[model samples]
Target: MSRLDDIIELIQTTNEVYFITAPGRVRTAYILVDDIIELSLKVFLQEKVYEQRVNCQIDLESASLVTSRNHKDSLRRYFEEKLNIDELSNELGRGTTGVPILQNHLVSFPLIRHWSANDPNARHTFDRVIDDVKPFFALPTTAPVGTPPNPATNLLDEALIRHKTRNKFYHDQNLSGLDINDEKCLSALCAMFDLVDHLFPTFSDEVKSKHTVRCQIGVLRLKQTASLGHRELSQPYEAALQLLKKGHKYDFERRSVEHSLVHTVSDRFFGSLREQFKNTIAKLQVRINKIDTMARPKQDHIDEKNDKEKLIQILQKQLDQINALLGAP
Candidate 1:
């Protein structure tokens, strides 16, 4: 499995672990959830760093108007932005969460050769790192009323705060009095579950691949069955939705009244529709071309044209139905 697949599996396992009945499961689940949030955040940071490096190189190679000063300022944002990091022309660093023991994995590539060394005098350092435990904390000023907030765009900062609680489980002086309980544990698990769901990546997310988008939609539906409270028997409308989310993956799976509406198979339904439409349209086009090439009376030609147009219009409506079912986006 790819890294994204591994992380997604971690999220799935974390959710299952929350339901374990062991006495220490609460504390164990909390620690595991925190790890999920932190790992996702750090992975996101690494991806962003690599993407920025690639974009900068492309701009430079294409001889775009982007200047070195702009690149330098962009690098500075990494250091100033916590999970974002940089202290030199040759080094990209991350550990802004202030975890005491960290393993810094090094990547060697020509595009990011700036990280090869750091300048002693120009380095930036923080004696202490601090941040608010601010996930799902939002107060909007300009957004329309009733607009929902995006709780955790990047959870590196929030994970750091939650880490403090996790640390108390092991390292705190309050050996007997550490405030770990069902309520707090449940609340944190719910939050962490939500974060892990957000961090799951959809492959082929370029908006240009239909098969992958449908696959992603299927994956999301299965993931959300628990959160949407449809883990058991789904409501009628939700059952329909679940069917839609299942898409091509579960087409061959046995259907039950709990999740499926139809027992009939739509075997190769979309591909068949496309093939049928293409052949009909091709035949119609050939007839129209032949009529246009022939010398006929103007009145006769007009009548034939109108008849052909109506046929084409009817075929077009059928094609529209196909397009609507197989949406472009």
Candidate 2:
């Protein structure tokens, strides 16, 4: 039996299940398995020895709760390699929000008072959960008592293929830049948020992630991809012509480009914009120091001459850099 079939069979043996769905570039459907079989599988998969120093920091305020220090790195791998979101979604009869929510839950657990830090015993517990269900990944098929066995299929892989098709439609069709209906453009905006939200529950708090703020700002200046078979597409249509040719790929492309560009610029400018501010402040500090020296009761007029020249030169250079950065675009 396929992994998906195993999951479905396991669920069928259970009493009830809860589900969550998320839609975006890809959809993730999650089925909540609160059974012994499900819990055991989780522990087993989590037990694999990670070759890195794992940080089990419970409090975010004390210090940064850095998790993937020596681990496989990346939340994406956690979903695909560990939980297998797509298969889980199919088992639950939901869309795609399943994987992200589980990731969020794992990361959101409170500091367990009895949890041992860096203890192998504690770590083994997680492993055991996954080990119990390792067979789910490779269960043998019984073929329903010989009706003719069907080939196994990984639902997650199928979902990924579907997601790619939708992605091309949304991004490659590139009709975003034109003066089109606000509703479609608005939907794109919502879709962007929804995509991130579905894929990563830690999406907004992505600010806390490595270089996330910079990356998010970078997303503003993206480009659009023209729809397929629109080589003859042109601009400035007549009012009547405009009404007829409503769904051009150019409109989608334009919106995508504009949104991406906005994000790119925001990330580039804001990420290190403070450094520029500090440079300006340093220049001002030189002048302030000179002024303080000049106002002193024992002001050395001889030293003031050198100080004045240095301050003037520093301020001029600072102002020049500021002007250049601002005027660039």
lDDT score of residue 181 within candidate 2: 30
lDDT of 2 by residue, 73-191 (tens): 33224333443545534343334775564345445432221123223254434234333333434445754555532211232233233334334544775733323232222233223
TM-score between model 2 and native = 0.18
Q: What is the alpha-carbon lDDT for the whole of candidate 1?
A: 0.45
lDDT agreement with native, every candidate: 0.45, 0.33
- Model 1 pairs whose backbones collide: 78-84, 78-85, 90-114, 90-115, 91-114, 91-115
The stretch of ten residues in a row with the least summed lDDT in candidate 1 is 124-133
Instruction: Show model 1 residue runs off by greater than 4 Å.
Output: 23-25, 64-150, 153-158, 176-179, 200-329
The sequence of per-residue lDDT tens digits that candidate 1 reaches over residues 47-130 is: 544655666555443543224665545544533342333233223222334221111222322223232122223322111111
